[model samples]
Target: MQLTQFTDLGLRVVMYLAAAAPDSSPSTKRVAEQLQLSYAHTTKVVARLSELGVVTTRRGRGGGLTITELGRGASVGWLTRQLEGDGEVVACEGDKPCPLREGCSLRGALRRAQESFYAALDSVTVADLTRAPTRTVLLDLTRPAV
Candidate 1:
């Protein structure tokens, strides 16, 4: 199953914060610019993350975004599940049911595959995505432009 852009951005934001220095709190604008994402979209994503208690935001001068402990420890699977919600993977359950609904195993197979996907993700945390090489790259990319 494909992840939505929202979820993708959220994961990127978390990884970026994870790679940053402990005391360095970056602003959403900086993150947007660094990641080449739209400022408005980043703002909305950050707001949702803040509301979810994954990231905390501070206002005014010297203020920025920081990942919470929960965020740091968040499993990729859990995050995806939360972000994706219970949305169906296929159109099998829509108003117009598939003709094969009664005897088809495709839905069940897809569901199992999705669960496997998440299960694999569960083994990795957000921090796990920021290993030395990746962390170094993210740090360089996230450095504010002069």
Candidate 2:
């Protein structure tokens, strides 16, 4: 199952925050620039992360984002599940309803497969994803250019 760009960017934002210095809080714009992404996209991702309680954001001067302990310790699978939400793998029924909406074995199989995918990641954490080289690179992004 493919993750939406929003979910992908959210993971990156969380990783970046996890790798940042303990006392550092980078602004949304700064994060966007560092991540080489559009400021608007970054802002949206940040807002979602904040709402999820994984990251905190403030406004105005010195206002920036910091990952909460929940963010640091959160399992990759759990976070992805939260970001991805509880939506079915396929729309199944929408403006153009599926003929098999009544009873579809494929839909149930897909749901189980999706859950398996997430469960596979349950053992990994954001810290695990940001370890070593990744952590180093993300940490460097928070540093002022010299």
Q: Stretches of candidate 1 above 4 Å error? A: none
Give the per-residue lDDT digits (tens) of candidate 1, residues 11-44: 8888998887889889999999888898998998
Candidate 2 lDDT tens digits, 16-113 = 89998888888999889999988998988898888889999988888889999999999999999988888999999889989998987999999999
Q: Give Cα distance to truth, residue 94, candidate 2, Å.
A: 1.4
Tell me the spans in candidate 2 whose CA falls farther than 4 Å from its real position: none
Q: Which 10 consecutive residues of model 2 have the lowest summed lDDT?
A: 137-146
- How much is the lDDT of residue 40 in candidate 2? 91
RMSD of each: 1.6, 1.2
Q: Which pairs, if any, clash in model 1?
A: none
The lowest-lDDT stretch of 10 consecutive residues in candidate 1 is 85-94
